[model samples]
Target chain A: MIRKLCIIGVGLIGGSAARRARRFCEEIVGIDADPENLRRAETLGVIDQGCASLERGVAAADFVLIATPVGAIEPLFRALAPLWRPDCIYTDVGSTKGNVVEAALRVFGIVPPNFIPGHPIAGAERSGVEAADARLFEGKRVILTPLPESAPDALARVEAFWMHLGARVERMDVGHHDEVLAATSHLPHVLAFTLARMLGRKDEQAEIFRYAAGGFRDFTRIASSDPKMWLDICRANRGPLLELLGEYETALREVAGLVRSDDADGLYACFSEARAAREKFLKSTENNHA
Target chain B: MIRKLCIIGVGLIGGSAARRARRFCEEIVGIDADPENLRRAETLGVIDQGCASLERGVAAADFVLIATPVGAIEPLFRALAPLWRPDCIYTDVGSTKGNVVEAALRVFGIVPPNFIPGHPIAGAERSGVEAADARLFEGKRVILTPLPESAPDALARVEAFWMHLGARVERMDVGHHDEVLAATSHLPHVLAFTLARMLGRKDEQAEIFRYAAGGFRDFTRIASSDPKMWLDICRANRGPLLELLGEYETALREVAGLVRSDDADGLYACFSEARAAREKFLKSTENNHA
Candidate 1:
């Protein structure tokens, strides 16, 4: 059991971690740049104590979870470098792993043996301490991209911590994690944001939204997610996201060509393939959860 | 009360209409190219009678609703033109209005005064008679694009029919309806299908899907919709859809440029605007329902 757990950036992800980790840790401390969030976290019983100072937060903690945006993680590591404890297991819930890994290297010249970069594939559109839920990570997949220098015990402890909170953990290479996430998460968000912007800016925007059905609403729901968080993710995972966007644009152009030529058979083939693939993917995920 | 209501293409939309219309009409007749669909519609009590022949189905029916895919609407219009009755009011639930209007003109040398083109903005990923829901159109918007020659009584009757089924009816020009729907519905579906196809065909398809969370699932849910139906929509509304696709591609490229340049502020602005717009749109829709 963790003697004490420190969570930095105590918003939705951090606050949620603190809430669930309370059962497995003796003490839970939350550190937030925003004093209001820190206060809310403490009052909500999501954390046992709140600290405005990062040094005070991690003073005697055996585990530290940095749950900031990808862009802020590097500076956070720099702040933690001097007070870094070798025996403590350090991890993060950043959306992009490569950026977090790079941040650690830039901060300390190399990833410390106890600093494991991880991402939990779970979230809600709402953020802040008030939205924290103890069951946020239940049945969710948590990917840990442990560096070569990462202590074996540190990795094991991090995995066990997530599992204790009802998450399924998997290990992956940092670069691969970024690429897969770019395809599945980042690119989708970009498309959703772009689509919403395009339609929302139209002169007929009111009428356009009035006629939109459940399908359109579902397709663009991600556009309502926290913009600053998504902006950081898009910036952190730019290379893979841009590559996928290029490929997706090409595919869309091909479909447009089919429509232009009135090639019913070609259009049918493209849509049918997508439908079958999505159905198969959904079935596999259901089986995984089962 | 209507003497009889004939419904063609008795799948999800048509079957749903039949089920709900049973309360207002004396009898409901269903006609489908698929014999099994017709049989199921009758057995499920979604229709009072089933007929394989179009002529036999519409005999003595004062109201006829052609609920076929956009691709089949013209041919159905041609068939109905030969059997046209002066007193009966005819309407369709095709997705594209311009195409339906053109079909009526092409078949009868002019749009019949009694024929009204209507589209109900409600659907599900699943199709066929088995997926029919009596409440499918409840609280949904139904767009009616009545031609200049359309009989006032006929348009009023069609509007009344949809209102009786718990839908809000609005009349729009045929061309304008196509443009608005292309932006709100068709383009979103196209994007979903393209994104799903691009990621699903990847070599790491399994890994990509395994890490994808609720956002990706919700964003691509429309990709699971009936392929043939969407193919018909894309083809029938090609002009407006292509125009919107080009505009959308340009917008995507601009967002990509922001990412490539790591212009954090620009990315934040774009995403923030989208989030705010979507939230506003959602609020308006909620208010509409309220």
Candidate 2:
């Protein structure tokens, strides 16, 4: 029963929200700095109208989704703090929560009640509005890291909005959210990027990639994610990411030590343990997904 | 035509070869220490007959495929060397070639002229003969690393045999093959295992995994690979794998430094380079696959 929904960014994540919210919201307004993206979102019927400026587009909206990159969230929030209606419920879909919450604190001296920091655990290697899918959030988890000032009604509204888009809603404190994602998502991304860049810089890269099996392909699949966005994410979540990297390097060093010492038993144990752990995770994920 | 194709350790790789070669070879004889695997393979029609004894199964075969773990290749080759006719061509599909070739040289005091070391660059997370697929090698690359003493006809026969099974064939020296695979395959497996194990061992692992998205899933996909088989490959290719892991750690350290120093440009460069490289690889892979 929302009167108007304003989605900032209008790229894959934002456009997808617009697509899914089209049926529920009375009107969906898309805002983006890039005219082509806005035009594409409008043409694809992902939104009812496109706005070049956030202030103008969000003027009448009761629900606002800030689907910008993690770095842009703070600046956008600051810009809209005065303009946003008190009655409007605000949320975001940035991967990193700590930075977004800190940004709010820095800009406003206190977090806004209407602002609920969220991250939709959904995406693909593709980018832009052209890659938008209405069902992108279907069965996906949408995490919210709400501040102390966040009102219950606002939080409830945001949660309901995500759930209506077919997402499972989760709430966590900013620190815990950052730590959890640092190990599971951010660190994996770092490894994938490093592995891909290392191989790409090699003289025998083409030959190496040609010979790479499905395992290698899958192992580095996330390396193909949008670089600008990933770069923003890496920078925004640097602290937690650094800590996770330390853990990963420690684990890797242990593995190398086992290999160097020719500890076949140790290596076998490590591999078997990892295989078992991954198999269990995969099973759980499948069950949850089903 | 190979009158009788004797495959030692008839698991995924061997059973797959057997399944595809049934039309090309007059008989496919499977050998394994695990009687249950042999029984399953026989029941699955992946093999014509199960050979309990290596001495008897390969005794009269025209072509012998030693498809055991890389560690077992030497002893099997040694056992077969003394018993087989000089006319019988020998080859193996071990992941590590240097160890396999070195084993032959160590056992016979000379490289076997009939033996051509090869590795089919194809696999699944699942292992065993029951998981074998006839199309596993289709559109896949199979690398052959032949010794100086290897007969030209033996090499040609191995190439033709793989080609007939729908694989594109390439030839490289044992050192190069090991180095390439170490970088592209072994190192990735190590990272996947390390990340998965590290996350799995954490107290909050369930929560971490529950929130993990597709990127995390795909990045650690190979962590589910067969532990024993991967352990064997890791041990056999330890030299090259250790070197590659060192390179990977160095790259990771460099990335960490960029993050610690807040070098946004450096981080962007690293991520963008990786993204571009992976995109290029994905494009080429898709084109070739198409």
Which candidate should be chosen as best, given lDDT against the real structure? Answer: 1
DockQ of each: 0.84, 0.84
Q: Candidate 2, residues A1-290: lDDT per residue as tens digits?
A: 78999998899999998888888899999999799878888899889999887778999789999888877887787788779678898889999988988888898887888889999989998888998999999999899998777999999999999999999998999999988888888888889999999998873444667777788788888898888888889899999999888988888999999999989899989998898778777876886588
- What does candidate 2's lDDT look like per residue over B104-135, in tens digits? 87888888788888999888888888889899
Question: For candidate 1, lDDT tens digit of each residue in B155-177?
Answer: 99999999999999999989999
lDDT value for model 2: 0.87
Per-residue error for A94 in candidate 2, Å, reads 0.7
Clash list (residue pairs), candidate 1: none
Model 1 sits at a Cα RMSD from the real structure of 1.1
lDDT of 1 by residue, A117-187 (tens): 89999898888889999999999999999988989999999999999989999999999999999988899
